[model samples]
Target: MSLIEIILVGIGLSMDAVAVSMSNGMVYGTLPRRKWPLAPLFFGLFQGLMPLLGFFTGTLFAKYIDCYAELLILLILGFIGGKMIYDGFKGDKEKAEERVLSLKLIFFQAVATSIDAFAVGIGFCAINVNIFFASSLIAATTFILSSLSFCIGRKFGDLLGNKAEIFGGTILVILAIKAIL
Candidate 1:
């Protein structure tokens, strides 16, 4: 994949993390500045790591699924993006605010958000892309977007509110469609 494509994929993959970060910001808007590092650190680490895991898995099984790799990427991206959009519009907004940022919660959120990147790693094998560069770009983009999401949520909590999730979801779905086309 070209650098632009890789970056687009990263942005698409980071939507979930962004939404989650926004939710965190809304809930913990009053948290002390000292604790700020925890959220981004945990988020960035997982966002970066998951794609590497996926890449290794893809490398192991590359020979078996080489022909269908593009289709697989489209399917995975579409599904993830569609799901995010659906969840954004349909999920319980009240519960989102109530969610606590415990270790277990963070871990689950990280894993859930990063699963698509794992699939993307599998796609990378088919396209003969540099896994290190692609994965790094994905992780870095996710980190920046997620961190910004938190700030946006905190600043516009009352006005943007739950609508941010809807916007994020829309972005994911659009990217997925673009990937397929």
Candidate 2:
């Protein structure tokens, strides 16, 4: 993948974390200044780490799918993007609104949100790109976006809501189609 595409994928993958960060911000809206960055920091860390884990795991089978890499990329990206789009239309109403935060809770949220990045790691292998570069781009983009979302949500609470997911999802789908042509 090109550097630009990798960055876009990072942004796309980050949407989920961003949404959650925003929600979490609002949930923990009353926190002292010192604790504000924790959630997004954890989110960024997991978002970065999960893809690396996935890439290494996927690297184990890279030889097997090398010949079919292009198709595999399409399959993975399409599936992920479609899921994101479907999730977007569903809206945010179904999610629970609760206050209070803990490290365990943050960890749980980070892992849950970064699960998609894990799948994305698998796709990275299909493209035969340097895992480090791709994961770094994804991680950096996720960090910036997640941090912004957390602040926005913390201050504003559920403003953009699910639209962010749809945008992110669409970016993935577009990139997937681009890979094919």
Candidate 3:
């Protein structure tokens, strides 16, 4: 694929990651400055890594992965989104500033969001694209977009207060449904 095509593909693949990063921002509203990059980095790394893995795996597991990718994404994002909604309604009343997002959660989100990219990588093999360059572009796009979305969500979170979680959770659930559709 050409550079423009790869970049476009990167943007397309990064959408889910961006949405999840935004959700994380809202949910973890007062996350420390040092930790701000955590979500984006994890997301970018996974987004990049999955494609390379898929490229290397080639056609071996393509059918299996394609068959189940949507279902897996649904379950992962659904569970997390449901939890966020439940927490929002439960009114735990913990200060947003006191909350810290767990690495496990970030890891799951990253994987869940990058499954489609894996499929794209398999397609890349068919097209004889440069896997490294495409994956790197994808990673960079995800990082930049996700970072911006997170910052935007943080501002909205401050304005929305407890409602932020509910909104963010809804976004994830919707994205999950969109994936299935």
Q: Global lDDT of each model? A: 0.67, 0.68, 0.90
Give the candidate number with the greatest TM-score: 3
> TM-score of each candidate?
0.64, 0.63, 0.96
lDDT of 3 by residue, 12-97 (tens): 99999999988988889688899999999999999999999999998999999999999999999999998888878876776544
Pairs in clash, predicted candidate 3: none
In model 3, how many backbone clashes occur?
0
Candidate 2 Cα errors over 4 Å, as ranges = 59-99, 157-181
Number of the candidate with higher lDDT, 1 or 2: 2
In model 2, the Cα lDDT at residue 131 comes to: 84
Predicted candidate 2 versus true structure: per-residue lDDT over 13-104, tens digit per residue: 78767766765565455566788778778877888887888787886754554455446556655665576578667765453222346787
Query: Better model by lDDT, 1 or 3?
Result: 3
What are the runs in model 1 whose C-alpha is more than 4 Å off? Answer: 59-100, 158-181
Answer with 1 or 2, whichever has the higher TM-score.
1
Q: Write the per-residue lDDT of candidate 1 for residues 33-122, one digit (tens) a residue.
A: 776556666667777787777778866754555445445545554554465556557668665565445676566557656656666777
> How many clashes show up per model?
0, 1, 0
How should the candidates be ordered by TM-score, best one leading? 3, 1, 2
* Candidate 3 segments whose C-alpha is farther than 4 A from its true place: 95-98
